[model samples]
Target chain A: MIKSNSTNSNIQQIKVAVDCIIFGFNDNKLELLLIKKKENPEKGKWSLIGGFVGFDEDLDEAANRILSDLSGLQDIYMEQIKTFGKVDRCSFDRIISSTYSAMILKSRYTEDKISKYNAQWFPITEVPDLIFDHNDMVDIAIKRMRRRVRNFPIAFNLLPPKFTLPQLQVLYEGILDEELDKRNFRRKVAQMKYLVRLDEKDMSESRRGAFLYRFDETLFENEQNFNL
Target chain B: MIKSNSTNSNIQQIKVAVDCIIFGFNDNKLELLLIKKKENPEKGKWSLIGGFVGFDEDLDEAANRILSDLSGLQDIYMEQIKTFGKVDRCSFDRIISSTYSAMILKSRYTEDKISKYNAQWFPITEVPDLIFDHNDMVDIAIKRMRRRVRNFPIAFNLLPPKFTLPQLQVLYEGILDEELDKRNFRRKVAQMKYLVRLDEKDMSESRRGAFLYRFDETLFENEQNFNL
Candidate 1:
């Protein structure tokens, strides 16, 4: 047991790391970006992109750096999920990690960056066994994301800037993992009033096509209490 | 910057501590349990009841132990709010602290135990200046508790085993920091249907008396999604 007394020289300083659970959406399915561990203790196993928190860096900075290094995306919508501090969570040392979850558009990542780290996008439902407690981190991240999407307008980070109503509904359905009646979903969207209809149309799905909509950042920022 | 390489001997281990923000409610106001620091390096200053996280102990266990030691309350409704890892947050060393928040009824703590540690309860609105980033910890704790009470049935933990609807409403008001319409609040409570009405009345507040209600844990457990 480490002593609370600050002057105790016998007290040990534990290593702290940050894990990023980056989520993306495409084809009506939720996806996670995972990489193969290239270091000792768990080399060649699937794992979350994580590294030790530098003594000079804040936890948030470490998360942003790791996310950018892995996905080549900057200013991503990231949240501090929680800290994982089990006594033996890491195999190599007594390391405590802070887990962060990020929602990014799947289209934002370029092929070159994805290949640079040998990172692959896998359907969240069929994620491969992860190294150490990475799997538990994913499970916790997913739960937090589900709850977050239900309460806030933050999930729009998972979609493109301009999207059709159907596309938006599909993203929500994928996240909630439940089917929504189209009429009821549209009604709820109409009531939100923070999504403005664009004059553009997405003709990819059908001949009639679907009208496009974009988030009203001004309104969202003004109305802090807006919820779906 | 600290190197991520595990073999780097120059990497320094940082000190970590756990601070507990224990909240209790009575007299329609939110109160916080704060103690005068008893150790050196800012001893006798107002501070959160905190201690070092033992190498062999889990973070949650450390939080529980600290809370019990300070308040003489065990198994309280405590949760990990977040980790504050700012480099200069501590004065003695490079210390990162994980802050936890706990809710308990004010009536539960005996006066003798509180005086044992020179602890005093202050309304959260007018908390005295605390050492280190403890004030920031309180602000974050309040925000998380507000969101938590709105989503979970855990708010009942702040009240006695038998409470009146008005008492429940007061608890919500204290947490949300807002006034709710009486008719609308009762209607929402009626819809929840998880509060079992008891055949008792509390005449302390009024001669007509308000009926007492007890939470039905069975019903709440059976219902998966209950929201406000």
Candidate 2:
């Protein structure tokens, strides 16, 4: 039998990679980011924006670095989803993958930026077949995202700074994948007491203007202990 | 770069193991179930009860099997705390370990069956050195147990079928590592409202027997949607 021994003086250490499954919303549509891998085994195929976790780096730092490398954004919300370590998960060697999920505002990319071979955004409804287990990775991330949103107000990270009640409702509906009664959603949000009216109205989207509101960050932090 | 491929082609996959750090309360102290390793890679050292996950099994099933293997019990409440994947975590090649935490009832362990091997209970205050990252695993498990008992009613799983009010209070105190006011603890538990009074009382320890109560599993399940 080929002994699985760590006593070998010549065996090399395994490389670990962190992948970020970032979701965004624009034009009332959910979107996901995919990057074209530059190097081999699985080159030219679209996959997650990911890289090797460096020495002495925490998992969150590695994930944030990958985000900055591709998206040019920093200090966005991120969470550790789960570690995926099935045999043959990676085609190269035994590369155990740790995945993190994040939400981004979707105005960061445009058509001019899309010409680059590095990364592109696809609507969540029309995403292309991803390379490797990335499709599975997105599925898992969405599950965690939905679970978190139900218990925590993390969807605010993906919304515009000044948004109307309808916009907030649309984000929740698209995320939860179910229709919510507008009156009930507003009632629930009011009960949570994290959103404050900003004395401004968004008049572009509809004939009757809707009042804009801002998420109370300090209040959210204070009341977060009561949340998940 | 090393080729990221499975070690062998067309062979059975490597087995996955889940070891549990089962802690209990007795004599106003926190205790851990430690077993002596029967085989090499640190044979004859005190460690936690562990076994391999079957192809059709989930991570929790593997942990339940380990509990049965050591204490001859099933349906024990357990939580998956963390997965350990340091390249050299195990002496053997690539045994990615997932550690689970369980709060076992002290009355559940069989003395004649438990004392057969080098298996014994060690108070959290006085634990022996363990093999590999098992000590790190225990540290994380205890941390989660303490956090969970403060916010959740998981301590009920570790108590006897019919326990007194003071016994329940002591379990929480042992887990939280703090002296709780007996009146305040009673008020908090009564507000949660899942416990039912039983007609029996324990007379062995005191002249004035204490009334016993057990948790209503159906009520707990019904209120699972809303936090206790």
Candidate 3:
């Protein structure tokens, strides 16, 4: 959408805001970071972490600022989902929001930090009714995330640095919201040479301990594996 | 992005605008509609058809209004490409514009109507340096269009109601910017049951004439063929 010219006498100046649907994965389920509104209008209701874009700020910078302030994390993998411009989206005013979907490591957000801001990670499937159009933002983000994981290794952003293949598969299954064949899933990962096996194992899941793996950044950057 | 609260005395309101990259396919090549800027900061230079969003207007409504005002056509296939929010993207002010890419049938734009608005079509590969961040917008839109054409039958929006297999292939090659094996291309298209072969033929390309085909909306809506 275009900006109204300063000379236009009748044009209205609408408020611009940014909302982020932060996704996390833990315990074989996808999680969403939601906070109880602390201000009036929709105060005390679940809502996506958001803030207004400063006059001199870039939309991305605003998104990052709000994200870091809320979750105490930096350099997370985020993508612009789409802009939501419904007139009545914000009951208090005419606010146009540029929404984004960010994948963050669930462990990065400490319990104390979350509690301080009244933020909590709810399972994607059981998220409470969010304020205004925040729920629609989450729904679109998950759908986009599901498609994104199949083509790119972006979902790895949600996994721990060292994770077993089963853990990896569980994350994929959770995002896809479907049961993937174990053999097929393994074969798919094996074909992606960017995944390097590590010496350590994750013993929490099995006594024998499934071997741990980490994404090889250098190889992933160089590989022509888009069809994966 | 978030809405700046009324109490934020230090916050500044930024300018917002919408720009559209109108796309068409004809003469075995992809085309983009561009207009000569009528007002400063860069008057007379080629620029995408754009306008500012009114205070209370929805973004989609603003997009449609600008498109129809310029092309005298409605119901165009348009999607939000991305929002360009760099501080220096616009020379005059901090205009954060949401860019959209639209697909239009070549026949829909008449020469007289185009000339009235000083709008003209340029080959996608030959588009001149556009105003502000429009070049970047077109570049990104083309990349996205390539991927979109592969998964969805959206490129058909650029074609007429009836088209030959060769014509369809030409449009695909134009968008993909690659030559496909005739046998392979035809085979892939034949497998899509949503394409209904018409008894009529298109004689423009060849004297013998090639049979025409039209997309079956009902079948296409029901089919699960995403690979085509």
Candidate 4:
């Protein structure tokens, strides 16, 4: 089973890396976490947090490890979005990067961990130019996230456990990058049987406080689509 | 700008390969193209048609190259469905494979080329236990293809340029592995303004032939969703 063919032996091996596009939602806006590169080639430049995969690690393992190292958190909701393998994508070396898009509760991360990695959260619309093909990666990740949010109840990952309907609407607008009609939006929300109304209300947005609701995971299990 | 970090230098490199899960439709059944391995650790076992990616080649390029070498056809409809890197998925060596799911018109491929590679088309449900983790790859590819067909008009890739409504419905049923109500299916097809009916009739199925239709690409370009 360890035998090698001529084709295998002659093929050159290339370094594989995993880059994480960590997304967070705050202040009615979608945000992205980017780190300032501390090494040469792209030193001081903003880039998606990434590193070479360990010899024994699987692609998903590598993605989770890299995200955990910078976030000081584990079990983050993440998925591999795509793999970018252009020969010169990385100017420093021929590294094939498998990129992942992660949704994390922004309030959970410790500030100390963020400072240690020189990480900063930029509002999705105002992100600075990133090094290498990291900008392209972010754009693609956002598009994937937008498409995913329409079909899955993944926005809960970016929201607090208890939130108002308006808050949920704002989050969807941020991800979709378009304002939705209020009546139409609420009509769609009413169809979702998985949103449990809580007794508590949030008073910060208006004098007439809006009731808070929690996403019921157990109920969602029986549901088919998150068409909102 | 070309400086490498110690982490990059210390990391191990692995061979990258591309495996194509080529799908086709024939006789109202979905089929998969698989080749019998000629050499070994698992010689004579059925496997996905694949090869080590050239050092200078992009991943998509490698997929197309591997597929064309076997089928002797270029410009096939292919997409990178997922990348499999379970560390030991391949027993022969430490290799990472980026898998692609491709849809090709079954009638277009020459029989000589298929025989040359010991390739055979098997009904998707009857696919044999393939070499390595190819079965898992095929399963993932099918799931991706199913999801894709829901929101995209990719089924056209598996059908001839000119086809009848019955033929199209049969292809859909084969891909979805489900029976559809003839009236309901036709109702949905009626909404697709892009399906242009021609004066030609296909009399192969019955004395009163079905009207032939062509998918109008230009009209589809302006339309948003392929809800069918």
lDDT of 3 by residue, A1-228 (tens): 334354642334677788988887666677898888888978889999898887778899889999888766567757898988877787767778898887766666566777777688898879999988998888888877776677568877677788888888878777787887888788778867899999888788778989999998878767532310
True contacts kept of 2: 0.09
The model with the greatest lDDT is: 4
Interface RMSD, all candidates in order, equals: 5.7, 9.0, 5.4, 5.8
Off by over 4 Å in 3: A1-11, A157-168, A181-228, B1-11, B159-165, B182-228
Chain A TM-score values for every predicted structure, listed in order: 0.82, 0.79, 0.81, 0.82
Residue A70 Cα positional deviation in candidate 4, in Å, after optimal superposition: 3.4
Q: What is the C-alpha lDDT of each candidate?
A: 0.79, 0.71, 0.79, 0.80
TM-score of 4: 0.83
| Residue B10 of model 2, lDDT score | 32
lDDT of 2 by residue, B1-228 (tens): 553333533332233567888787777778998888878867888887776655434456667877777756567777667666554565544455667777766766666766765568899988889887798889988876775565456778677778998888887778777788777677777755678888998887799988899998887666443320
Best by TM-score: 1
DockQ result, candidate 1: 0.32
Clashing residue pairs in candidate 1, if any? none
Q: Which stretches of candidate 4 lie over 4 Å from their true place?
A: A1-12, A159-165, A186-228, B1-12, B159-167, B182-228
User: Distance from true position, residue A15, model 2, in Å?
Assistant: 4.3
Over B133-161, each residue of candidate 4 has an lDDT whose tens digit, in order, gives 99999999897787767555778867789
Residue-level lDDT of model 1, residues B127-214, one tens digit each, is 9999999999999999788766765677887778999999888888887778878887787687556789999999999999999999
Candidate 3 local lDDT, B1-228, one digit each (tens)? 234354543334676788888888666678998988877779889998888887667898888888778766577767988988887788767778888887766776666877777688898889999888899999999888877676568877678888889888888888787887898788779766889999998888789999999998778757532310
Error of 4 at A142 (Å): 1.0
User: Higher lDDT: candidate 2 or 3?
Assistant: 3
True contacts kept of 3: 0.32
What fnat does each of the candidate structures reach?
0.32, 0.09, 0.32, 0.41
